[model samples]
Target chain A: MDLFIAIFTGTIIAATPLIFAALGELVVEKSGVLNLGIEGMMLVGAAVGVWVSYAGLPMPLAIMSAAAAGALASLLFGVLALTFLTNQYAAGLSLAIFGTGVSAFIGKGFGSAPLDALIPLEIPFLTEIPVIGPLFFNYDPLVYFSFIMFGLISWFLYKTKAGLVVRTIGESPESSHAIGYPVIKIRYLAVMFGGAMAGLGGAYLSLAYTPLWVENMTAGKGWISLALVVFAAWRPARVLFGAWLFGSMTIFQLQGQALGISLPSEVLSSLPYIATIVVLVIISRNWQFLALNFPTSLAKPFRPAE
Target chain B: MRFQIERRVEPSSFMRFAAPVYATFSTLVVGSIMFALLGHNPADTLFAFFITPLMTINGISEWLLKASPLILIGCGLAIGFRANVWNIGAEGQLVIGAVCASGVGLFYPDPESALLLPLMVIAGMAGGMAWAAIPAFLRARMNTNEILVTLMMTYIATLLLSLLVHGPWRDPDGYNYPQTALLPDAALFELFDPMYRLNTSIFITIVAVFAMWFFTERSFFGYKMSVGGAAPLAARYAGFKQSGSIWMGLLISGGVAGIAGMAEAAGPLGQLSAQISPGYGFAAIIVAFIGRLHAVGIVLGGLLLSLLYLGGEAVQLSLGLPSALTSIFQGMLLFFLLASDFLIFYRFTPFPKPIKSGVT
Candidate 1:
């Protein structure tokens, strides 16, 4: 029972960053823009988050600054993909490379600087309960933010008219524009929102997860989150579930010995990436399902007919 | 009052070449501003970063030495890029190639065997092809996205290399350093000059460059693959198999990158270590694009990009700047290059052009 609770808690903690990133990407893709620079945005966010914290600001302010930095970074992608009308993939890629360089350049001296990790919040009433309360309630504020975002986003995506507009634009930007929807303007907003959420995810890393600034430290989580979107079939709820699955794969590395597994550490470390490929293969093999759920306009550049 | 972008009846041939030069100029302008922000004399820093490294024979030799791998990989990447096959995992392929070549160099019965170098080169190519084949097979057979898959494979490849070096491949005689023993004499490349690290291995890249140029510019097979990229539906309608080109594009690039890895391991490095590539794979993407996916262009791009690397190292030593400044410049160069390509096919016209539509 203790072990079960521990794994559940660990999975939730691990899934927090993915939740923020994948969910954000869900909205971005729904709005018909594919931003492959999430990894770069996350790194920028992580570095900026740490820098803000080092400025002796409160945790919330630092996170907010990180989100702003990420949004600003996304603007570069927007200008290329939306305005100048470059290939979306190449534009996003350039943004990723740009983010990587800028983050590393700015993060020069903050690598070994002291970090103040976000403390887990334990509600007073929930603290007295046994396994269930500790399992569900005891987590850093970011975890709770992820859960709240999940519900809010689900509601926004399914119940709101603006969400319908975003979805319609994703499916057919021309038709949406014919119907008087501002496709380019809305896409820019969605991309920025995705960037901001990716930033928040980065904040979860440096401000809570490892609470440190390391160059390229996000490793490949940003890419994994992208796979998570495909694995989820662009659904918010499935994104959470997929995040947990990848989270378990990651925890396998930390808990391999505890689980009585003796695989090589390098192999163990690669489990999450391997699992992502496997999931993509399984999910992507169904062409009909993909065509049904995948955004038709995703990654395709839209130039508003002037 | 407003402007409209009109495609030129024919794209200016001059702009096709001028865009890169303009991008380079813009990159320098941005770099100068960045240097000023960092409180350095922009002119001095720029010179130290770009020109100081080529003032001596040793520097020139080292530049070519560093450029060989980049040129080799860049040429390979250019072929794939032309065919719309994004094999960004060349770094991983390079690592695996090095490991495979080193494996042969380390375990061969006759360390001084004359066949070792040839065998190592073959093994390196095969290893790279094998690694790249995963994404190729998946994309061709399963309809998977090669970009993400190749990238994921890169991560896995890095772990695989780490495992080998940390475990079975670690030098047993050497104190706990995470590297292998020095390779045997026959496994290493013969040097062109004793005073320089540049070796006979450059001939491999020289041959590859001409071959690549001929194949991409002149060959029927190359034409078919490019047609596949330029218009997949049209190619399919014309009876070209998409999978064939995908397989070829990936395999050729992977094999070339593998040779580059073998060069590093057998030439200057002479052993496998934790860090083998200085991002030759990723940087080669920029080189391919900057070179306009042409042979001559790639050579120039490779030389220019290699100079950027040397500049990074030089500035770090002479100006007390961080080595990562090179990455910043690289990213900026690509960004500017892609942005400047707007000039190639389109020009701004007055919004009231319809009122004067017959003016031209």
Candidate 2:
């Protein structure tokens, strides 16, 4: 029972970052702008978030600044991909490279400094309950925020008029433009939002999970979030499930060691990545499902006929 | 004056040629401002970056030594890129290649035999091909996205290398370091000059460049793959097999990248270590694009990128700057290149506005 609770709590904490990043990418992909720079943006966010926290600012301010920094960094992608209509894959790859370099340069000074971990939010009455309370109520604010985000994103994507427009643009930008929607402007906004969420995910890494400013600390979580978006079949609720599933896989190294498993640490460490490939293969085997759910214009550069 | 971007019916050939040069100049101009902001003299730093690295015979040797793997891998990647097969996992393939070559070098009964080196090279190519085949098979058979699969496999390959080095392959005499035993002299490449790192592996790269040129520019299969990439529906209509292209493209890249990995192990490195490459696979993608995926262009691109690596080290030594700045410059160069490529397809013109009477 204790192990179960501990594993469950660990899974929630681990899942939070992916939840934020995957949800953001969901929105971006829905609007037909595939920003492969989520890894880069998250990395920059992690570096900047830790730096800001070390500068003696309040935690909330640091987190907000991280999001802003991510959004700012994503503008480079927007200019090249949306404005100039360059190849999205190449632009996004450059953004990742640039972000990784910039973050390392900026975060070099803050290497030794550690920030205070964000305290888990505890409601006085709710805390006294049994398994449900501890599992559901006892977690950092970001955990709750992740849940709320899933609900809000689901509502926004399915219910709102703006969400329909975003989907319309993704399906066929030409048709959307013919119907008089501003495709480029909407795509720019979607990409920026994705960047901000990716940043927030990075902030969660430094400010909550690890509470330290290590170089390249995000360590492919951004990429995992990308796979989650695909595995979820571009659905917000499924994204939530996929995040938790991957998050559990991430904690297996620690949990297995705790259980006195004799597997080599390197093999244990590779479980998450292996699981990712396996899951991707499994999901992608259903070609019809993927073809149906995938956005028609996901990576295609849209240029209105002049 | 307001400006507008107008799409061209046919891409401008002149702009296609000029864009890279323009991007290079733009990078230098921006790089100067960046260096000045970092409190270094822009001219000296720029010279240190571009010219100082090539001023000596030793420097030229080091330049070629670093460029050998890049040109080899870039040539392979360019072929795949031409087929629209994104094999970004060349780094993983390279690692597996080194591992295989080193395995042979370490375990062979007669390491001094003349056949040992040749066998190691073949093993390396096979290793790379085997690693790449996983993604190729997945994409071809299961209709999986190769980008994600190849990338995931890269992470796995790194871990696999780490496991081997830390466990079974640990050097017996070395004190707790994660690396294999130093390869025998016969297993190593013959150095051109004992004083320099340049070795016989460069001949392999030269041959590879010619082969890549012949395959991509002059071969019928190459034309078929390009047709598939340029217009998939048309290729299908013409009865070109998509699966065949995926397999051939990936296998060719894997084989070349593997040989490059073998060269690294047998040449400057002479042993398998955990960090055999400094993201050569990823950087070679940029090399392929910058070289326009042409054989000759890749050679120039490889030299230019190698210069960047050398210049970064030189600047780090002379100017007290962080080496991370090299990656920054690399990222910037790619960004500028991608941005400038827009000129190939479109022209910027001053936006025509409605002419109003001079009442205002």
RMSD of each: 2.0, 2.1
Chain A vs. true chain A, TM-score per candidate?
0.98, 0.97
Mind giving the per-residue lDDT tens digits that candidate 2 earns over A169-219?
999999999999999999999999999999999999988998887877887
For residues A37-147, what per-residue lDDT tens digits would candidate 1 score against the true structure?
A: 899899999999999999999999999999998888888888888877777878877888788888898898875867888989978989558886888878988899999
Candidate 2, chain A: TM-score against the reference: 0.97
What DockQ number belongs to candidate 1? 0.77
TM-scores of all candidate predictions against the true structure: 0.97, 0.97
Top candidate on DockQ is 2
DockQ of candidate 2 (2 decimals): 0.80
* Model 1 bad stretches (over 4 Å): B1-4, B350-360
Interface RMSD of 1: 1.0
Query: Model 2 over residues B1-360: C-alpha lDDT tens digits?
Result: 999888888999898778778878888999899999988999999998889989999999999998989999999988888888989889989988999999999999997899999999999999999999999999899877787778778888888899999999999887988888899999999999999999999999999999999998899999999999889999999999999899988988888888888989899988998888887887888888888889988998899888888988899888877777877877888899999999999998889887899956
**lDDT (0-100) at residue B106 of candidate 1?**
95
